[model samples]
Target: MQARQDATARAVENADNLARVIEHDITYTSQLTDLSIQAAVDGAQDADVMRLPDHLRRELLFDRSATASQYIGSLLCLDSRGKIIVDSTSVVPRSVNLADRTWFTVHRDNPKLGLFVSRPLQSRLNPGEVDLMFSRRVNHPDGSFAGVVVAAFRLDYFQNLLSGVKLGPGGNITLLQDDGHVILRYPNDGTPVDENFSGRKNFERFRQTHETSFLGTSGKDGKERLYNFRRFDKLKMIVIIAPAARYVFADWTSRAWYIGIVTALLIVGMLFAAQLLSVEFRHRLVVEQQLRDMTRIDGLTGLSNRRSLDDRLMLEWHRAKRSGKPLALLFVDIDRFKRYNDTYGHQAGDDALTAVAQAIARNSQRPGDIAARFGGEEFVVVLPETDGAAAAVVAAAIHAAVRGLAIEHNGSEHGVITVSIGVACTDTEEVTDALGLIKVADQAVYRAKASGRNQTSMAEPFGGAAVTT
Candidate 1:
């Protein structure tokens, strides 16, 4: 399928080159037409050419010396034909009728040759008058009517012009009539074609896009030549044709099966390489993220470990120190965990630790606060921007929350897991060292155990001042 598309694309390219060649020919012809008519119009605008005798019109038209040195030669005239005025050395005349034409109208209406333009065509000639019409009109200085100017090729110009142009090697370009009739062709397919084969079953591809197409056979010689065709809207349907296999690019596409195969393989290889690289990268990233998470998490309980809690305490301590705000720390431990483990199995002890860790995590109120299992049955919390008073309230809440747990603790004194909490508050002076705050909070936890288990206790803000209950 790709090979087929490649062939089609090559055919289109061949057609495009053909169109350009034709367009170049048209442009050269149009420019020549314009220059010649301007010369004639200059003569008509002159008092000499305008007022000269009809016999003297030729002398004035062709008399370059009569004008300044800047003027080029004028359009040459010939043909002893009476009604069909003939021209020599210029464009191909393809249409019939000249006098009542638009060129004549615009020539009469507009004085500037630059204003209006037309395409070349056959001239309608009659016997007696030897008349001719023009492809374009030129204007007089005062906007009055000027005469028509037609091309008079030097000699067999169309034949010579078509023959001289070089299409790409393996590519052959040709000119045609609107009906798909060959007017000019490379490799010289001299057979004349019908001028009415347009918009038909035979030439549907060419009709659609003015594009190049490959037909099976030209049928004239039944030879296989790639067919690229174009039709001119301005010329009432003149067509230009070119064949593939003569142009250089056509040769490249001749091996399209091989070329397309290489390109497809390269694309597939690149995609597979990209897929492999992405899979490897994703696998590495997943493992790396798990490693990072494990460093901060307790293995037995899914809580932030002690290493993370130490970092969190220092962070809150520094924040309180700079802002002159307060920081609070809570020290938590499962009441009589060692006794419970001795009485029950280590598995039961593990269950008690998990329940205690959950209770502490649930009690942390703010997102900025830290809740971590600080090794064994001990847990710690860091509360930022909180004073001694606020910390006490939070500590009380945690104490109450743990006591209310309905965990089935067969070895616990309270019939379930409970934690004793020690709250310590710090001011800027005491926050100088985060470890100092942890030590005081730990000492408070010892006080809670000494006074009575399963209760909340607090330490001084900075100095060893007596804490109010």
Candidate 2:
């Protein structure tokens, strides 16, 4: 009787150790996957997917996470109505409406549900394969539901991870949602995925506490087994490792000395695997950060891209509004750029553009200021807390810097490259929002061009004349 009791205690201890290893693996995977989804969300907000071309939009929203992770089946962005607007798998999203899907509805209905893990379900995109989805809610600037960013993982991936460990006869590993829905089970015994075990007596213990290991009867097979379970409160996940009590006792009786040595070796191997995964997780985070930084910069001139400009403009607009401080915008356009391209080859034009962009970047060196290539030969400089006069001084400095480069532009009357500058300030009564400010600044640019090629023009205050410097 004493020997039997000792074997049971050893079984419980082994199962508990194994459960901790599985929990570590899963927690890391989930955190990394969620981080990828969040990156997608931030990208979506920075770029307007609706206006972008299919391939460009997909590239903007999904990064290496889509293709780099072996376990991830796909990454997706759905619209407010649950229409798939962006998909990582194809340039063009599949024509599928997931309005009825539980994951979609949960996010759409619950604004505060930051991250969610869905029950296992067959993938609609990949017909034969089952998936477990990790999703986060997307919201508009006003906090209305915009959509969801989803990362789908193949159910087989979890099953394979769980099956790697050797368990004696009638041994099994199960992953469950907090609600007791089985996500995956190793050595599948024909039990359905997503089968609810909340009502089972064995699961009752898990609901009552964070971790446990004991001998209990199998709720399904009616056989005695040593069960070990661990719960992740934040992730709402549960992992269970169970081996039949009969097998444990028989093995212990026949080779008690060998059992301890084997268990030690298995534990070491699992710990090593966990360490490797940790290293991989940290490496992925670094890669993701680099990718995000790449997206915000213009490839040609090394200036802030249009997408980045939009985000910064919106952010500054709100800050200026709240603080009641003046915000200034400068619109700089290369004088007769098309003629410059015609006179010099496209490569020379690119060089000239880069030089001009650097000049503009140099003048707006304030920490709060942003200089961006608006598009082509057009550039914008955002100056926070600056009035029209200060903005014009910055614009004049940019004008002088371009003239200093003295790049030959035979197409221009000056016989050298020059730029037209338009300055606008939010202190004007007519400017109501960031878009309005941009429009005013653009009109000022046109006025500067109309006056001459190398000058600065500031938008007129209400009921006043335009200022040219």
Candidate 3:
């Protein structure tokens, strides 16, 4: 009963943390998009890009493109009548009318709205690909509506932001309009998935707890997930980070297997000893088993400690060499964690660390995947038979899981807790020792931390430079 209660509490806490992390990231990105579109409007006004002749509009767009790197698609300036006046990607003067578009209509109807975000739609220019538009109302000097200035960012832009986060085969992250229209889902399977939860109880639940997280089942995939409903009011959307329940409890499942085997062995030993040995001998055997278990687990996080990880890594390393398969190692560190400890006190810091460890464990789904608390705020994962690309997928999942924790951190630039991950993998012939693999992974971790926190970096097998993702 105590174990069950503890597990429930941890699940609830993890759900809340994941919601906060998604909210923070979506809010931050929305603010950036708002700023980007606003800047484009200001730039258009300053450069007279809107009023320039059609022949020269292309030139203006070229100049603008040279200086900006924010938008993944293109920028557009539309006339009050809905005719395209300037397009950044268009070389020929194309006659496209975007007057019927929601983004354009919303701004035309409500000029007071600083920015308008559209639901995911098929791109008019980039056909077959979905796009989300960020638009701002462009006004004349006299405050009359001139047109709409749009920054059409491809849906892939948002997808790439989460490309690294893989939650096993069933894990998914979704972005939805506040109205519950599905905008994006990761692991693009090529089938058009209309996962809109609008008009359903789940959508209603989202409206009720826009700032919090709750447990729910996904209507699209039919998986019970820890759901977070975070609204970016400015962007008119909500981001949901939902890892399937099975994946979330994977570590617990692994521990259960270990416990079950040990219990069975102990039972058999006791039965045999009942006929042939003394009672004190059976008690001593039980005590020895308990001691062995203690040595392998980290008390605070309930994860394998460094000692366990070392043993597991050595075993996996030899197995990989014998099978001629790849062995992957990931070194994870909470970014700006010292400042978090200083601000939140050690107890809160410990809680944060525990949460981080749990996130790592949840994402390391394979039975052979070893997640260990490697002292303080650092954690490690040993991925047997996993190549660099596959390890990167795990790394992304770990990043997403930790970011989901969203513990408050006043000192970090992100204003919330985040993690940096370093991934290193070796084919059988690349390294003769596990220590060399650890060194490579450790170097990648430093690179990830140094470049920026909340990102993943990978090291080449043969000690090449660390590459940030």
- Per-residue alpha-carbon lDDT of candidate 3 for residues 1-469, written as tens digits (9 for 90 to 100): 4554565467657655655666676667666666656766775565466566765755654454444445447777787888877777775545889899988988888879887777777888778877777788988787778888887767666666777766565767677877778887776644354456777766687676554556678666677876655666656677667667777667677777888899999999988887576667788899998899899999999899889988989999889888988889999988888899888899999899899889889999787999998888888899998998898898888877777887888999888888888887875234559987887777788988788778888886556655555
Note the residue pairs that clash in candidate 2.
none
lDDT of 2 by residue, 129-182 (tens): 889999998888888888999989887677777767877889888888888899
Please list the C-alpha lDDT of all candidates, in the order they appear.
0.61, 0.86, 0.76
Local distance difference test, candidate 3: 0.76
- Measured by lDDT, the strongest candidate is 2
Kindly give the stretch of ten consecutive residues in candidate 3 with the minimal lDDT sum.
Answer: 60-69
TM-score of 2: 0.52
By lDDT, the candidates rank as: 2, 3, 1
What TM-score does each of the candidates earn? 0.50, 0.52, 0.49
As for TM-score, the candidate ahead, 2 or 3, is: 2
Candidate with more favorable, higher lDDT: 1 or 3: 3
User: Whole-model lDDT, candidate 2?
Assistant: 0.86
Listed per candidate, the RMSD to the true structure in angstroms reads 13.7, 41.6, 43.9
